[model samples]
Target chain A: MTRFALTLEFDGAPYMGLQRQPHGPSIQQHVEEAVHAITGEQVTLHAAGRTDAGVHALAMRAHVDIEKAIDPFRLMEALNAKLRPEPIAVLGCAIVPDDWHARFSCLGRSYIYRITNRRAPLTLERGKAWQVSAPLDAAAMHHAAQHLVGHHDFTTFRSVHCQAASAVKTLDRLDVVRDGDGIDIHAAARSFLHHQVRSMVGCLVLVGRGKWSGEDLKAALEAKDREALGFNAPPDGLYFAGAVYP
Target chain B: MTRFALTLEFDGAPYMGLQRQPHGPSIQQHVEEAVHAITGEQVTLHAAGRTDAGVHALAMRAHVDIEKAIDPFRLMEALNAKLRPEPIAVLGCAIVPDDWHARFSCLGRSYIYRITNRRAPLTLERGKAWQVSAPLDAAAMHHAAQHLVGHHDFTTFRSVHCQAASAVKTLDRLDVVRDGDGIDIHAAARSFLHHQVRSMVGCLVLVGRGKWSGEDLKAALEAKDREALGFNAPPDGLYFAGAVYP
Candidate 1:
């Protein structure tokens, strides 16, 4: 069997997220079904990351094995055509080594959380961004975000249902900046626990609103308790930007 | 009666257009209905521009007359509350003189069109931007756009359905710039003939793709013939950004 790596982009508004669930429709089920229709082979797609519902992806990587030899371009075109009516697109396709797994071979992951810091409700960016009517101090949020960087036990920012064995993870970067009328929080790490990025953003939002300070974040990290953290940011603002390979 | 000016924004994917149409739902009908639902007053809203179907608005200006006194903030909040589920928002509201009309009193109007130039189909900006796989020379497009600026008879760019009395109009600004993977076209004028902006963008796209030159645009303008112009750009990329009043 030949392994094919596909890069994809999708609007996560309508699905139950990246993984296939018996409860509802998913990005994986639709893509796999499309691939099966094209190749006449039942294939399982292994994605680099499983994003939550309402969380978009710009360049999500996935690996699938097929028995037939197929041209990458044709495969991409056929998959896209079959996945029609669904807000998903196969951006790029390439042949990879049979042993190269999409999730295991990944070295890093990145995400972007968008927040529209304006008094007005979003029209154009309705489902795409988090709308905060109160003005957010991005600079303050950036300062507070710095404390959360580097290797640390992120229990305060991890979901209760996270399957990771330990809360300790290395954070390579956490950047908060203003773009137009919105504030973007860009995070990068080797890997992350469930809802980590959203949890951190929720705390940073408090900092932006002057309700919390850098010291408060530092204390939360030290406490290593979920109760110490602030609210969880809505899923609308989150995006699975991409995964990095070594 | 008190006259209130409102700055509005909407995603025009669901509505027919800015003006009330007998066939399909329009932004005007939605706003008017929301206003009546909130205040129990049947009021008509006059906008600075009547955008076509699937044409979004970033900062559309409108004026409404209320027979009874009302707080601008409360009225705006009530209208927004009632307009839920529809992608429309009242960005700002203010009390204005009876003489201040939404359309006639406008001094300047600005618009922006976004084009995603990439090989892949857009996921995030599917309806919000025009996606073209071909690589576009934005610098060349910018150079060509300069030729269309200044007072001139824009008959070639004007639509046959345009109701403007005169074809001659002053174009204050027309700029094409590249932003990341997208191209942004910004235009400003005292007023514009119907389809003028879209027509200009269509011609500019050709220029950017090396199919035409700046001299060709000049020739088209000088010809003052509809046949001289290129295709009209899709309404999805066009936005009524804002209206300026003196």
Candidate 2:
């Protein structure tokens, strides 16, 4: 059997998310079905990260093993051709060692949250960005986010549905930038607790709106209580940007 | 009657185009219907330009006369609220003099065409960008486009349906720039014939693909015949970017 690594880009509006869902359609289900059509094998697809509903992926990495002898380029072309009418695109394919697990071998992950900071209703960016009509001070958001860029107990910033054992994790980066009427928050970490990035972004926006301060963010971090969470940003603005490996 | 000028942004995938069509929905039709619902008046909406089907607009300028005494901010907010779920936004609204027309008062117009150069099919950019899978040399396309940046009889570039009295129009700018897997073609002029920008972009793509050269483009321009045109890029990649006023 030969293992193949696949890079995918998908719009999450139509699917449940990146991982498989028994209750609804997901990116993985469609991709695996396309693979089954091409190779006639019911192989499992492993992904680097699992995105929630309405969260997009720019370059999500996945892996699958096949017994059929197929060129990577031809496999990619066939998968793309078969995944038509769906929003998923197989960007790349490459042969990998059997032990190169897409999930376990990943060292780090990054996500970017997009916010459209404008009073006007979103047109071109609808469903792709979070439209915040209230004026936000991005500088304040950046300053407050600095408190989150280190090792800390982030119980307050995690989702109730998170399956991670420990809330204590190290955050590598959390940077907020403003461009025109848009605000982008880039977050990187070894691994994030479910909803950690969205929870952090929500509080940062509160600080940007002057509803909270940097001291408040730090206090919430120290509290380690879920009830102390300020807010949870919607999944619509989140995107799985990339995965890093050793 | 107070004339209110509106700066609009829209995703043109839903409507026929920006103008009111006899058989189809349009940006003007929806905006006018919203105004009638609010003020009970049959007011006409004048736009800076007419876009073909599926051509988006970033900030197309337009004007409508409203007899109801309403603040610009309120008007903008109400219009946005009324045009809900239509992928149209009123970015700005201001009172303009009666003599200032959205179409005639414009000194220049600018457009941007987006091309995604990649092997993968588009997902997030479906109906929004033209996808070219073949290798494209943007520098070669830029060099060929420079030949179009002056006063000339552009019958070869103009559409058969173009109603301009004269085919001679000075093109102020035609620039091609590549960013990652995307190519953007920027065009500016006082006025352009129907399909002029798309025709120019199609020939530029041919030049980028080595199917044509700068000399061929110059010869096409000199031919000044509609049959001399190479191709016309689809409306999906074209955007009515902005309008210049003096």
Candidate 3:
């Protein structure tokens, strides 16, 4: 048996999410079906992170084991060929050790939320970014984002349905930057509870729009209660940028 | 009557072009319809450039005369509200002098063509860019493009169906830049013949791929015949980025 690590890029508009679901299609199902058609063996695929519906991925890492002998290039090309008409691409494939698990072995994960801070309704970037008509103070957003950085109980930022046992997690970085007319919020951590990034971004936007101050954001974090959550941003602007493994 | 100079943005996938057409929908038609629905008076929209099908625009300049007494902000807001579900936006609207025109009075126009230089098929940027599997030498393309700059009778680059009265036009700038996995071709000029930018880009790609040398590009330009044209790029990557006026 050979284990392969695949780097993926997908537009999450049409799929329910990254994980398999009975109600609708997912990235995993399409990839699994493509693998089955190629290897003639039903093999399960494991991913580092499970993104929500309408969330995009730039370099998602996944792993699969197959008994059928195939080269990495051939597997990648064949899988990409079969996954056509769907907004998914196999960016790279590499053979890996059998013990390397995609999810369990991941050391860090990162996400970026894009906001088009402009008055005009987005045309080319309609679904790709969150549109905020009010002019944003990115420097203020950046300053406020610092309040959420470092170790803390992020209960106020997590989803109510999150299954994680503990809300305590170490946030390595939270940065807000302005690129042209767009504001990008980048978040990094060893692991995150469900909807953490989106929830944090929602609050930061309020701060950028002068609704909340930096101290207010820190107070919300210290509250550690879900009721204190200002808002949960939509999944359209969230992107699983990449993962790191030791 | 108030003459409004509107800064427009649109995704050109669903339209025949920027101008009104008898068969299919156009950007002008949508703007006109939106105005008619709001004011109950038919009006004409004049654009700085008549872009082709599938050619997007970032900040297209246009002018419209409305007989209805209305404010610029309200007119813009109402037009945007009425142009719903379509990938179009009125970025800005301002009252302009009656002598000002969208097309005839324009001092300069700028365009950008995007190419994804990679083997992987585009997922997030499927319709937003042209995908070229082969590697491109941007420096070589830039060197070759320099030969086509300045004043010249660009008959070779003009389309057979081009309606411009004269072939002599000055190309102010043609820059080729590489941004990570993408290549951007920026073109600026006072005016251009139909399909001029695409034709030049097609030949520059040949040079980048080592199919043609810098001398060959110059020779093609000097030939001044449409038969000498190497190719015409697709409209997918073309964008009417903006316009300049004095």
Per-residue alpha-carbon lDDT of candidate 1 for residues B45-98, written as tens digits (9 for 90 to 100): 999998999999999999888887789999898888888888999988899999
Report the error of model 2 at residue A215, Å: 1.0
Ranking by TM-score: 2, 3, 1
CAPRI verdict (incorrect, acceptable, medium, high) for model 1: medium
Worst 10 residues of 2 chain A by lDDT: A14-23
Q: DockQ, in order, for the candidates?
A: 0.67, 0.90, 0.80
Q: What is the two-chain DockQ of model 1?
A: 0.67
User: Which 10 consecutive residues of model 1 chain B have the lowest summed lDDT?
Assistant: B118-127
User: Which has the better DockQ: candidate 1, or candidate 2?
Assistant: 2
- Superposed by TM-score, candidate 3 places the C-alpha of residue A109 at a distance from the truth, in angstroms, of 0.9
Q: Which has the higher TM-score value, candidate number 1 or candidate number 3?
A: 3
* Candidate 1 clash pair list: none
Q: Write the per-residue lDDT of candidate 1 for residues A1-246, one digit (tens) a residue.
A: 889999989999998899998888899999999989999999999999988888999899999999998998899989888888688999889999887889999999999999998877788998899998778899999988999899999999999889999999999899999987889999999899999999999999999998998899899989999999899999898999999986
lDDT by residue for model 2 over A79-107, one digit each (tens)?
Answer: 99999989999998999999998899999
